[model samples]
Target chain A: MAKAHVYITYKNGVLDPQGEAVKDALSSLGFQGVGDVRVGKYIEIEVEKSAPDEIRGEVEKMCQELLANPVIEDFRVEIPNGNNNPQPPKSEA
Target chain B: MAKAHVYITYKNGVLDPQGEAVKDALSSLGFQGVGDVRVGKYIEIEVEKSAPDEIRGEVEKMCQELLANPVIEDFRVEIPNGNNNPQPPKSEA
Candidate 1:
């Protein structure tokens, strides 16, 4: 089994109104000096009995076709342990 | 500047129909053996000149107050270097 993690965000040039609203909310709530707040979607897929590369390809297709809006959004996929763990260990060896 | 990565997903036991729909869509598209497809949100907040721990606290409050729904959704925050670098190095040094 392989798990694919997908992150979908607006293209850099695209304006994200939702993110702007959230920023305003934060400022109002007394979070000082917040710079930019951008929101996106994160999706996880568990593909059974498929190679990591195959799962990656399938998920990328899904992202292009439905998971993200190509006109304004950009998406990325990562297969955990295939290089995406972003968190530190509980204890160093 | 500090960048914070936030991942928000449905709490365990919560129904994720969007994820289910996507799973069915994948099946229709002929990708076989896809299992447990789940969807969530990814948010990035850029805060200027703050300590890692302080940024963590602010983001957590933001998550609770507006970013994520405390009822059905759960959220987590990661300060890039505070311990999340899941990707392997480009070259073994």
Candidate 2:
């Protein structure tokens, strides 16, 4: 099985009210030295077994088609290599 | 300045309806081999200048107080050491 982790964040110029609210709430909660805060989405996907490169391509297409809104958000995908590492073949005596 | 990145995810065994919806949508859209999907929150915070360790502690408190719900969500904090790397002072010639 191949898995992908996708991170979606707002564009730099966009106003993030949710982040703003969290910052205000933190200030009110007496947490000092808190500065700018921004919020975004994190998604983990598990897919049928395939090559990591192939899975990445498929996930990228998925992101473009439905996962991310290109107008105001940018997405990055991380495909971990641990599960995809090929096992060493057993040596014949 | 120290920066923190927090990832909030659903605890294992929690039903993620949003993830299910996304999976269904992907199936309908002709994307094959998609499996389990999970969604969560990603938060970025910039804080007043401080040591990375101190900033991590402070951000932990913030998460407990307002950012994540402990009942069903688990949060992990990562404080990058990039911005905090020290620069050597130039000696007077």
Q: Which one wins on DockQ? A: 1
Q: Quantify all predictions' global Cα lDDT against the true fold.
A: 0.80, 0.81
The DockQ of predicted model 1 stands at 0.63
lDDT of 1: 0.80
In model 2, where do residues sit more than 4 Å from their true spots? A82-93, B82-93
True contacts kept of 1: 0.88
Top candidate when judged by lDDT against the true structure = 2
- Residue-level lDDT of model 1, residues B37-69, one tens digit each, is 889989999988568888777788788877888
Best by TM-score: 2
Query: Candidate 2 at residue B93, lDDT?
Result: 14
Candidate 2 local lDDT, A1-93, one digit each (tens): 788988888878889999999999999998777888999999999988578777777887888888888778877777887333543211111
What local lDDT score does residue A5 receive in model 2, on the 0 to 100 scale?
83
- Candidate 2: C-alpha RMSD after superposition: 12.0
Please give, for residues A36-68, the per-residue lDDT of candidate 1 as tens digits. Answer: 999998998888746767777777777767678
How does each model score on TM-score?
Answer: 0.84, 0.85
Clashing pairs in 2: none
